[model samples]
Target: MFKLFLLTSLLFLLPIFHCYSLPEPCSGTCVNAHDPSIVIRPNGTYFRFSTGGKIAIHTAPDLRGPWTYKGAALPNGSKINLKGNQDLWAPDVSLVDNLYHLFYSVSTFGSQASAIGLARSPSMDAGTWTDLGAAGISSDATKRYNAIDPNLIYVNGTYHMSFGSFWDGIFQVEMNSPPTTAKSNVQPTQIVHNSAESAMEGPALFRYGEYYYLFFSKGQCCGLDRSRPAAGKEYRIMVCRSGVSTGGFVDKSGRACTNGGGTVVLESHGWVYGPGGQGVFQDPVHGPVVYYHYVDTRVGYADGQKRFGWNKLDFTTGWPAV
Candidate 1:
């Protein structure tokens, strides 16, 4: 009948209309979450590690709900004694050998006087993490790389940390077993570099099927006051993929990522502004999920006012969809 046809037509059109509206996050306080990284406990508790306030810890029973702000992971701060030791950034956490190992960044903004440090906890409970000093990688002002935004990835029976910011783009280095430190005598290799040679950081590497998806942020990341960057120059989630862990990453367009080519995974749309600093995890309920910090234009754009956002990734098309 005409009535039945009208109902079906509206149903198909709804997704096109609502696709830009991101799902709301957390039932309680999800504010102050910048550079968000998610780790789920075996018992289904979600722990959020983010940059700021000594790597602040927030937890929830489920990803959607009644989140509670737990205390700092390191109340006393990092043991590395760097300039930004008290205010950690870009925490990448993973559970290995029954212990939760966290790799965090210690650096001041715009300076390569930065170091990545390691810490671990038997349980991801707040105040339980013990700093294990630097993870054996650093960069000074004279270096080509800024050495921040650390993401821990395991591939082919070895561990590698992908990190970089501003100056050069993204790089990866091998780590020995236990992965407490970077392997000595091994030089870091450049994995993904934008051709423009600027403003790419926060690499979260993951293996989905045959390719290693290199998800990173591109363009201006902070200070979106008054005016924003011109269109694609604002902070957006970009991705490249490689068959192997080390290099040869290309975008969906078959363009080399190192040649300033990357597929935009998510960008400013509707109320969601400058969504980057992303991390991914395979969730039991949601499957593959990408979590990030986004400036909700409705809320304001200060770093502290940033919000945690997540979406289940659809890889049906051989590339991730938010």
Candidate 2:
């Protein structure tokens, strides 16, 4: 009877013990990236494209990479006639139709004058990208949405894009075949927003089980030295899920994402600070993984010095946990 009692008590205590355990810190070299979008090539190479001069490229044999710099994806700069076209941000890459399509943001910092550009390459190697002009555009004066931070996901033979930052949060638009531009005459739907600060962006949609999970970064990103938002609130990852692809997203509390609802997925802990601008990819070996950039506060806040971060996501609870 004592053995039976102890066994029952242990089972009751197991979940409590697990809940107190800290999450696994991201390992390996994480250097020089912001708004990183990663893809594993067919040849087993990992490529990470990030924000910088014409979209920076980093390659490695594995996810825990001794990453090597391979120049910019578009060394010639964007075809868009924006003021800061060379200084790109938030690149998302995916394999489509035997070509690797890379969508990147072209914009000046702190301005809504932005355009999302497309570049395609037969290989993931640098200097091979053929610039395919502007996929979408946004301006401060007329458009309600900003077109930076583009993320593309294909669902049931259709392509959909989620892009925007700051002004009114995340927006989704359908893309026609060839996947370069948005479908003509269709308006983008506002899928996620933060009522408090209007500070949600970096929409990464992942289809897991019966739900479509929309993950986005909320609060202030970048400028860690000069400014920081509320402690533990700045640049954290939040999520909502929907049964269908286009709309009806809600948080863990059953609140609609359209009304500033989201469940916190990852926030600052230990050395990792302001971990935002995230993307999700399914690894052949590690299952589902979330990738992003975080400020290393120990190293002091330096421009372009943010480090890469990734962790295998746990979905046993029917929702993604880092």
How high is the CA lDDT of each candidate model?
Answer: 0.87, 0.84
Least lDDT summed over 10 consecutive residues: which range in candidate 1?
15-24
Q: After superposing candidate 2, which stretches have Cα over 4 Å from the reference?
A: 1-29
Cα lDDT tens digits, model 1, 71-159, are 89988888897799998899999998999998999998778899999999999998789999899999997777877898888777899
Q: Clashing pairs in model 1?
A: 195-260
Which is the leading candidate under TM-score? 1
Question: What clash pairs does model 2 have?
Answer: none
Cα displacement (Å) at residue 183, model 1: 0.9
After aligning candidate 2 to the native by TM-score, how far in Å is the CA of 32 from where it should be?
Answer: 1.3
RMSD of each: 4.8, 4.3
**How far does residue 25 in candidate 1 sit from its true spot (Å)?**
3.6
Which numbered prediction scores highest in lDDT against the true structure? 1
